[model samples]
Target: MNRNPHGEIEEIEEEYNYVDAPAWTVDKVAAPQDQRSLFFTQSFPLIAVCWLILLVIMGLRIHFTSESNAKLTAENQQLEILMHLNSTLLAAHENLGRYCNNLTVQFDLLTQNCTVLESKIKDLTAVNQQLTADVQNLTTRSLQLETQRNNLTKQIQNMETNWNKLNVSRAQWSIDAYCPRENNARLCKACQEGWRLNQSTCYVVHDAVSTSGHKTWEEAREVCRRESSDFVIVHNQEEQYALNYYSWFSTLTTGYWIGLRAEGWRWKWIDGSDLTVSHWTPQLPPAADGQCVMSVQNVGWRSVSCAEKKRWICKKKALYV
Candidate 1:
């Protein structure tokens, strides 16, 4: 069919040329093979609405999954952190045990050192006690020595006093020698012969008798006076030697009397001359013998009774220089 360009009610060109007797019928409608694309084309608005709903649903699901995953990851991280903390705690516990052991060892060493120090202190104390004892002993010894020294000083002083007394006596005797006798080994032969003399006297000696005969003291004194009118008196050693040379002294007894007597523990001649010349035994005047005098004869002196009679001795002092 030919259609006018711009006429109303013109016949439309048919796309498929239905040749032969093919004509469009109301009962036979043409249908597409794939109805999805046709439906998308015809129902665009409806498809758009369905697409939006699907997108919203998928977005919701994605959101829920992501939230679940995040929760699990956070839980896992917390567990891992707890495990690390446990491991760190175990390491710290081991270190603390080791430190405790080291401290114990140090404490033991300190205790031992303290014990040694205490022992040293005890030893020092002992030494101090010994030193104190030594000092006390030394002090005691010094005191004793000082006491002895004082005693020695007193003794020496006493001896000096005795020595001075003896010296005084010797001085007085030396002055009594007016006419010193000649030295003849303690013998004065010239003085005995009336040639050399002291004062205004000469020595006249009786003979010595070696015979023994007991005689009373009064009888012997009387005989001595009768033998020489001037009376026999001893002058020097030479006169004694002359009497001995003449055998006038008796040897039977150790002692003989001249003119000596103890008148109340004192002896003096009848002329008041001190009887200083003594040749008698020690302690001659017997305490209970009633004897008051002693005589030294040829041997030794002995105490004699006043009533015995024996050979007597005497000396004569001639008044001639």
Candidate 2:
């Protein structure tokens, strides 16, 4: 038996020849048909129940498969979005790295420039210091030169004044002293006819040829004063030596009266200065009131009484031409 597409059951009949059979075979066939019919009747409800259980299992499988396909599609779309975001982030990072590199280069250049400027400033400072020192040295030198110039100017002024006075003195001396002597007419020498010139001074030695020519120290000094001079004043070693050389000696005891004399127990010159230097003889006696100084040839000075008679020397400034 079969079910058609229209939902109706149909049976196919087989053409069989009728033949006589023995009773036992017939009984055997009939019993088998009854048993098969009983078995179909008993299993029909259980077969329906099994078919229902199988249909339910197939429907659940199809539903679970559809849900799994939807979940897989959503996961693929999310993965694509994540890949796009990663690409954009990579591009931004690259740009930032390039900008950082440029900034670093600019910073390095600025640092180098600053270093060069600092070196230049230091060099300028050193040059300035050297210039300042040079200026100070120049200032000091200039001040010293100024002081020297001032001193030289004063000296020149003094010399000019002295020269003028000397000219006036010379003119007066030429009229008063040189013009009156007939032997020295038209021949103006440094000394007069009877005087001897030693450097800038004129000296005259009066030696006594007779006893009348000899004079006491006071008398000798008065004679020099009348001649417009004074007794020979030994102011230095050279003058002393010259006097010793010029004085004529007839005996070892002979000495000339000088201008030095004792005043109030101290030796004084005719110029009123105290005796700071002396050429006294080794045997000179102690000085007292009325003691006077005299010079001996090849010897030294001696203290003698003012009343003693002796030769004398006179000294006066020479006339300038």
Candidate 3:
């Protein structure tokens, strides 16, 4: 032990010397717990600690990435559903537009048909009114024509009555050339409506007859009414005037028979006329057998037996006027 100057003890190392040998290595395997190994023994614990921290961080990242992938798949399915719904809505709108167009065209045709029917009804009403007016006019004209026809018939009947009054003779009378009668020259035909013109006298025989098929005087008159329009009658004294120039018969001895009869001196004409005058010779109607006669001397009536043989003077008329 050695001490310093301040009285401390001092120790001393003995001098030992080691010798350098030649290099020779032994073949040996290293063990895991060898602390003195120079290649990896000191850093083994640090490497294990670092590998455990990296495992922890990698586990956390794997969990987060799995969650993100599931969320993305759900969003893609939702977008596809929305696209299908939009396409269906667009197709429905196009179908509805086509149906509305068809309905509008049908409504226009119905309106046009109604207007044509109204015009046809107006034309038919006008034609019906015109026909009614024409029918009324024709009925009024027919009534007026009937009234005029009735008035004309009355005038014609009056003229016929005046003309017939001059055709029948009552007695023998003579007139000179002053008055011209109707027919005296020619023998008249059956229905001599006009007379034969001559110098002094004008006469006509419209018809003459010797009647029979009679039972009584009254029945004979009725039968004559069916066959002739006028009964036997005489008109005036001068109507019995003889035809002088161109007579049909030529016997100057006897006068013609006029329609005259007597009942108890109550003188009557055959057509029921009053005895206004007479052309009787002296001593007429002496007895009951001398009541009727035929003209004998072309002068006047004379009494004779009713059965005497003499030609009866037939004429167009036999009734006294």
- What is the TM-score of each predicted model, taking all chains together? 0.30, 0.44, 0.26
Looking at model 2, the pairs that clash are: none
Model 3 local distance difference test score: 0.44
Question: Which prediction has the highest lDDT against the true structure?
Answer: 2
- Across residues 214-263, which tens digit of lDDT does each residue of candidate 3 receive? 12233333444443322233345553343212222323322223345555
lDDT of each: 0.54, 0.79, 0.44
| lDDT rank order | 2, 1, 3
Q: Where does candidate 1 stray beyond 4 Å? A: 1-93, 155-321
Candidate 1 lowest-lDDT run of ten: 9-18
**Cand. 3 TM to true fold:** 0.26
lDDT for 207 (candidate 3): 24
- After aligning candidate 1 to the native by TM-score, how far in Å is the CA of 87 from where it should be? 5.5
The lowest-lDDT stretch of 10 consecutive residues in candidate 2 is 9-18
Weakest ten-residue segment in model 3 by summed lDDT:
9-18
- Candidate that beats the other on lDDT, 1 or 3, i.e. the better one: 1
